[model samples]
Target: MKTYLPQIERRILVRPNQTYGILNYDLDNAYPQRMLELVAGSPTAKDCWNKRTKFIAGNGLEEKDLGKQIINAKGLTIAKLLKALATDKALFTGFGIHINYNADFRITSVSYVKFEDIRMGDTDNAETADKFALYSDWGRKTWKNIMRSKVTFLDKYNPEPEVISEQVCKAGGWEHYKGQLFYFNPEVDDYPLIEADSVWEDFETEAGIKIFNNREVTTGFLPSTMLFMQSRREEAENTRPDADTYTGINIPTQLEKDLGAFQGAKSAQKIIVIEYEDESSKPEFKAYPIQNNDKLFETTERSVEARIIKGFSVPKELINAEKSSGLSNGSEKKQAILEFNDNTAADRLELSETLAEIFSRFYKDINPGKNWNIIPVTAIAADDNPGIKAGNAINELLQSTLPRESKIAALVYAYGFKQAEAEAMCL
Candidate 1:
């Protein structure tokens, strides 16, 4: 009898925007306008993310433009463009780039496109997955009047909806073509945009918390309410009436007039009041003052601060901010700092790789086989006592029975010592 083997079922997961010739409704429904609004309105989000970008894009990368003199247009340079990219990425959680080159093999210009204006195109093929088209609200402004106008004032008040521009790129070509739709495909090595979906919510939340804190701080954190007291309406009718006193005016009406006058005055005055007493044996009065409740939200504020720090992936101690948990000892604090530096180094490497690939592609298109190098500089973070660490490593190598010459060479190279100096130290 012949035996049959069972085959395992498999599935390949792709980005939400990627579908095999099928429209991705989820990505289409992502309400980017609101997301952009949320991020744009957040100061904390801008600060945290921008700081990271600034740290990674320090001084920009060194590049060989192949004598194209591309940066001359509008006094633009690689560093300025990189800074713009960093800022766009921080604010929009994505970066969009437009490369302009001439037919004579020269990279004429590189522009950092706004993320809000980009729409992802065909993703069925890896070659075309990174393709996109840009939409804009330019030339949509209209004149309107408040009353009896052909265009309604409300239409003017409302933001003009973005419409796709004519400019677009197709797959496997450097030529840009016009299109009515908001999508296009490009056969590029990698996507023209780098996006982070997971961190977007964190950025929005951090921004919202910061806005709330700012508002609270400005308003003097308090609970405000309205208080109304029904005063006795009966007037004190003296059996012996006097012309000196006036009882015709209502207490509430007089109070309102006094308040309006006091508020309208140019000079500041303190301790003003409209005193009123009822003729009834028992009088009633009530006051509602804004009660401060800052202490109640202190914990929430701290928690939000911690979350914002974590979202930015920064070391709190670096900014002189203290965390409520862990990191108790000196070693722990040191480790925290080291970890932050490591993360920064990793970011630098990743950014450099991406920038190098992009520049290489652009440069190669203009001048085939030309040199374009993008190097990211990162600071070295070693142990608190490098001498001790080196000594321990050297001792370990010695006990492992490594060659004397190899050990001496290692000492000289690792510790940045001269050959003679290392030899004398080893001796």
Candidate 2:
């Protein structure tokens, strides 16, 4: 005797396509594109991704003027560039920046490149990749044909002035030479896994649950049922001209038309009627009652949502504000913001460091030193008195019978006021 059991296995493979001269991202070179679709289709995943992106970007750079300075001819500012990079980093755990150079071998303009549009060039060594391939329609569905002219090959970012000058000279000019691409993938793999990659199945499950509910609603929440009817036979001369001769009027077809009329919201709750000749030939309407799995679906959706949020390392309070209690909502939200900021500190730091290194070489008027930093949104949140409203606290303090000194002390200590300022206000 033999017993069979189902086994499921998943693997992430990086294969090189010699024709394209690029290493495929997870067998198809479309992992990032697939991830984009998955997030687009799933509400929870999209929410988590958005929240992660926003948190990572925070309030933009510490230097307001520097952030406002345009980086490219398109008027893309440093702040906008950072946000775009944060969006890709939150989604793909990687991002790419396209850098152009002038005749003097100096950086001229920088633009944000979509992470999904980039592919690492095929290389014998795993540690280094010299070239990067960029194509907008990797799916090949948008355009009739993806011609060689549509694909651009870019050199990996090299900071060495000598290398850039030599490459520019060899290519005959700066315009002829391809721009350099700054690819950031901190995960140390051929390609970075998406932030929510571990819970991708959960994303699919959540999307499936939504589709299931949509189908159920569209069908008026009807159970799967089978309709059986005895065929009506008539003499050959009695059959109508338009009737199906062999089936004698096609009762099943008529029944289907009648039943289809009752589907969807517009025709819901309408009575269904069937006529038969006698008890022996009565139509049997057998409903295979589908068990009400609303609760099961709800549970599964919640589980999948939780898993996706966890995979993104986003706090639950941030995504679903209603889940937190009304009394402690503010405090809980503040704590969640702080926690999320801490979680994304590394991401912000990486972006900040990369921008700092790149901008240090930019034109002197725009570059604001090597200490480029992005302020976390938590800085603003931390300053908030979440536990107690300041107006309410002041009202309570004023209405109390406490001495002036005591009130002033409370204001200084509890409300973060300077002692002199608190005393003057109390007086």
Clashes of each: 0, 0
Clashing pairs in 2: none
lDDT of 2 at 319: 92
List runs of model 1 lying over 4 Å from the truth: 1-36, 40-43, 62-72, 89-94, 122-131, 137-225, 230-269, 275-292, 319-338, 344-347, 361-427
The global C-alpha lDDT for each of the candidates, from Candidate 1 onward, is: 0.46, 0.80
Please tell me which predicted candidate would have the highest lDDT against the true structure: 2
State the lDDT of candidate 1 residue by residue for 337-424, as single tens digits: 5665556564555445545555553434543554333344343443436434655665676566667688678766665555665576
Residue ranges of candidate 2 with Cα displaced over 4 Å: 1-10, 125-129, 143-146, 231-254, 272-282, 369-371, 379-427
State how far residue 31 of model 1 sits from its true place (Å).
5.1
TM-score of each: 0.50, 0.78
For candidate 2, write residues 1-427 as lDDT tens digits: 9999997654467897777778888876678878788888899999999999998898888875777888888999988899999999998888999998876667789999999999888886443258888999886668766565778888889968888887677667866987799999876647878888888988888889989999988899887888787764532343566555555344345566787988876678899887767898887879987767988997788889889989888989889875432234266677888888999999999999999878877755575355578888753353355444655667678679999999888877776666666787677
Clashing pairs in 1: none
